[model samples]
Target: MRMIEIEKEQENPKMNNLRNFYERALQEFGTSDEDLWLQYIQEELGPWGQPENCGKIHWRAMKFLEGQSAESFTSKHALFQSGRL
Candidate 1:
């Protein structure tokens, strides 16, 4: 069962495209807002209804996005406080 799941993920083009879209959204928005992230994802998925179709993928991607955005903000804040930025 696990092997089959792995194989399915490996061969999934939609998942790959979703990841690419996440990357593009991060680059374009550069903000930590979850709504913007969801908007971008919904736009990309486009009437496919992500919550029903790709819930796990969207959840994982959102977690990664939030973490990345938080880390970036913390780093920039630290740099600014230390007179680096």
Candidate 2:
């Protein structure tokens, strides 16, 4: 079994591209074990799983969309942020 961590996330364009590639690969080559998929993503991206990475991506996107800086964003209050939740 694996454990996932929730932390202040950051977005990577490369990661998004990789996810799209993976989606296409899955459609073309068929599916594989989820654990294997996670392992592959971890190796290619980082320690966090895809969902967590995506969350980080969303956070960064939101920050950009709102014209906010990292210093202006509150990690602890993210869920309560008007446009974030």
Backbone clash total, candidate 1? 0
**Which 10-residue window of candidate 2 scores lowest in summed lDDT?**
1-10
| Candidate 2 to truth, TM | 0.29
lDDT for model 2, on a 0 to 1 scale? 0.38
How do the residues 33-56 of candidate 1 rate in per-residue lDDT, one tens digit apiece?
Answer: 544444444544554335454455
Estimate the TM-score of every prediction: 0.29, 0.29
> Highest lDDT, which number?
1
Error of 1 at 80 (Å): 36
Q: How displaced is residue 5 in candidate 2, in Å?
A: 26
> Candidate 2: where is the Cα deviation over 4 Å?
1-13, 32-36, 39-85
Clash list (residue pairs), candidate 1: none
